[model samples]
Target: MWRAEESKEAYEELKKKLMEGLRENEKIESILKALKLFNSRKDRIFKEVDDLEELREKIRRAKEEVIENLDEYIEKAVKKMEENLCKVYLAKDAEEARRIVRGIVGDAKLVVKSKSNACREIGIVDYLESQGIKVVETDLADRVVQLLGEEECHPVVPAIHISKEKWSEAFSKETGRDVPPDAQAITDASREGVRRAIMSAEVGITGANAIVAETGTIITVENEGNISLVSRVPPKHIVIAGINKIVPTLEDGLNIAEATTLFGTGQRFGAYVSFITGPSRTVDVGLETTIGLHGAQEVHVVLIDNGRRDAIRDGMKEMLYCLNCGSCLASCPIYMSIGEKYSCGYFGGIGLSFGAYIFGAQRAFVDGLGFCTDCGACSEKCPAKISSNDLVREIRRRAWERFGLLLPPHKKIRDAILETGNPFGEPPEKRGEWMKSN
Candidate 1:
């Protein structure tokens, strides 16, 4: 799937389709609508709180507490998890993560997955499927894009750019059957199909929103209950998550969850928030503890680094602090205009730099860099104050040094000024030709 020819063709086709469907006026309308909804929801959520600033400060402190003693917290969590009969593996990178999962899921033919950016980060689905596992995405948006053989276009709402009309068409094409374009019918059809997949899945995987070190529990919040179904019905469940998701306590996890929900989906809380400690167990009939009553019999937590530790060591720890709220995607003008093809695995301003670094800096820096308009809206709304614009510039500079890519357009304008002493390159005297004293 990552072949150069296929990747290039896919990129070109995506760009053409997006450009044709998303005009400047339509982009403006979408942005306005999204901003209105986001701001209204933010206001409603923040209105009842007595001291918003205090809450933010407390959350920041909680994050600092974890970062200051990361190792100790991880050890504590591992020990607690082991006591709960849950297997834990700490992966130094993507390869290690893949190995750990493969060992646990040996010979499993069918696997179902929740919508996890982390899985995409490690190329989990593709790798497992290549190894002869039939992997299926259970999330509605994820399933839609996967069935269409397309990459995700947004971080939070993966298929928001797809209209209901197009969704119906895609469903019809994929299913080889006539499907109505009516919204309710389309939704029901998709849901029923995925429901069957979830029930029969042998192994289920999900991403962690937050991990409570104190309780050794992982939390996942989603609008659809698919994640719960996947994690519960499957015989084995694996949670692939970044190490930085660990929090010091359950309260801290809850606080992070609330902020993430408001920032990500413009909701106070998601429809389902699953806090799983270990496999489901019961001691009823014979007074013998038996696991897998209602939930997965075996649970594994794979803590993946995959360059995150290196990013932290290089002083990019703030990026690790992200709750995956995806607020930046909603607020980014570039993302609103172009959709997921431009953003890819990660979305919005922050994703541009991180995705490029992890995926391929040269390609991302040159192709994805120009997508951003240097609009400050994303940074302003970001809960973490991550300077995404600055990171993009830095990545572009590195790309030029490493791969000899072209400088960004703004830099070219600046270079012109330095070479000719005038940004316009016209005669200095002619600079005032258009000026008229009123």
Candidate 2:
């Protein structure tokens, strides 16, 4: 489904997915259940914030400062990381990123990966698999999605649509036995599977929460504790991140962590937060330095730009301010009906913004650019407060400008309005003509 440019195949596939998601389905019920749980407790989560606007504003401004000066920050961060003995590369796009990672892999059989939206964004799993490299997902939800042959529905909870029975089925296939469809049983099985994969893998891959350019620190936040294991157990760790993840300081990274949990999971913070700088090292034995004592011996960070640079150049910088939080989708009416299939690569109006730039404006139309109602719920719930609705509308306008195919449905409505004074094409007269019904 991933291509350097727009493809007819991608459009048709996404259109089919859009129709499937719109119908009544168990995934819709499951998504509704998850959103209900999230909605019920979000008030308590936000109530703890002493100065809500101040916190949001501060975080936004700090990130905006870095994004505005991303080139400088990336340069400084790359220098610092290289000084810390980590291999670094600036990948101009997804293909270059895949090529760099493939070179690092060099025929390695197993690569264990933690939860990473960036990895999904660039389609690394399929790429590696095509090269005969077996990539195992150490994260439980990601494992389930892989087993089910499904893509993520939400950023925080990728397997929200999966039920306990489905979980057992997904794992039972791997075990070749009848595992019980119970929560504890599923968790135990998944944990064992991930442990085995991590223990045997030669390389580990991860996405970033934020990168502190001042100290060359890469921060990853999670609750499952798999990120630490995946990043450490393997001899080599490879990190793929968007350039937008760069921040000026560790304090900024920590703020991003807080915002991620607050908006995504209604928590003040996640249970496990990992700040990795360079490879593992020690200097304890006779004051002699050694590396790879209990963690990765080598670390590689790939800073991927894709279309982000062009997006900024075209005045679409707000699209990069997303935290990948699913808060907006929880309230998105279109998302409620269609789940993640509404958008091509990701979930809601905000996701459409990213898809538009990365996939192209014409493909964005097929990715459900017209589905958004400009409700503004996304902006209200967004921690970054990036007017995603407005951005999506702007992308739709661009789609129309580029292809002139985005307005046929709207043209029909317009014609109906002009002829009958109603969008529904109902017959109409002057103002007093409707009194007959009463």
Candidate 3:
């Protein structure tokens, strides 16, 4: 408040105006409780870390090194991966990325994908499905979310908003199989459904945790082992990764993966950490190399720019450092309280940055990015140590500049305050009715 700055004062003032009108949202109560338990479990798992800051520093150095030399790293990665026999394409935006994917996936009737924020950011699954290609989510929670026709809230546990009973209902409805409300039955049923999809799918699409520039390795971490299958079983694999995922070496990538799972789900070592140098090949028989040995024969890596370069260019490089760990969402009070109401899937602080930097302000402000309470909890819990407050402020500023990025509700409140000196729009004299009664 003492900064004497118009934007900060106006931002906080607007935030106050928004929060003053907060109401009890009953739908999120159970979800909030569930998130609490989930956080506690994550905390227990993370408590075993020794010298956490040191690990974070190592991660920071690796990421910063890559970010500082993003173009150089990307060039190196592309060269190495191409030399490894993987077709690499760099897309300037989401549309081009989708276009390239469509071409790569030409004539494919069915495709399966693992959970990926980049895929979500580009709406690739939906885009592909729109082109008459069937895309199934292979990740357990993601599959459930797809079956439930819901948007994922948390990146790591996308289906956490839905109960096991709800999942059972969705699975039963989807598979036409007897899946009881029990976790085991639900899990078994989901696994069976994903396995069927995996077996029948013609292609697999996944996002990379890290793309190593040195060895041209694509690193993906998962606990369900579904990522392993989804990226391998099909004859063709399409890897969609933001250029920000590129690190200098396999060691850097592994460290990133380690941090991702460690912070994402408290798994020190996830069940499967796949390092894909190229499509699976065997050189045993006759000293001849043959591709497609229990893995994808054709591998296409789409290094999506999609605003990542813009993020770096515009000095919002911190956005590129994100691990997609969802730790910030888990720790943000605003998110925990009202869930997606605070920010729609991938449209909150980080999502806002995603929208502002890459997708443009129009794409982000539609979700009402103004809901961020500026509590700094998200920034605190973020393993990458990105400042959501600063990012949100910048997004708001740029968005305001572009299109007045003010929400309809906020506009109404602004009008109300100007006309009636209060947000409530009741008769001014009636405002003191409660005070008189007390």
Candidate whose TM-score is highest: 2
* lDDT to native, each model: 0.75, 0.85, 0.80
User: What's the residue-level lDDT of 76 in candidate 2?
Assistant: 91
Report the CA-based lDDT of candidate 3 relative to the real structure. Answer: 0.80
Off by over 4 Å in 1: 1-36, 48-51, 170-178, 283-288, 370-373, 397-438
TM-scores vs. true structure, each candidate: 0.84, 0.91, 0.86
Task: Name the 10 consecutive residues with the lowest summed lDDT in model 2.
Answer: 1-10
Give lDDT tens digits, candidate 1, residues 1-438: 134444455446546655753664554454456556777787787776566566556666777777677889889888878777799999987788998999988988999999998999898998998899999888887888888786566667666545677779877876678778887777777886788788888899999888899899888988889999988999999999888888899988887777777766568778888899999998896999888888999999999877676656656566666666677766776766665545645776788776665666645653466567777777665655566777777766665566555533444576778877887666677677777543
Q: What's the count of clashing pairs in each model shown?
A: 1, 0, 0
Clash-forming residue pairs, model 1: 153-340
What does candidate 3's lDDT look like per residue over 128-203, in tens digits?
Answer: 9899999989998888888878766677777666876788899899779778899888888888778998999999
Q: Which stretches in model 3 have alpha-carbon errors above 4 Å?
A: 1-27, 344-347, 406-438
Residue pairs in collision within model 2: none
User: Evaluated with lDDT, which candidate comes out highest?
Assistant: 2
Give the root-mean-square deviation of each candidate in angstroms.
Answer: 4.8, 3.8, 6.2
Q: What does the lDDT come to for candidate 2? A: 0.85
> Can you write out model 2's per-residue Cα lDDT over 55-125, one digit (the tens) per residue?
67867987799889988999999988898888999998889999999999886899999888788878999
Ranking by TM-score: 2, 3, 1
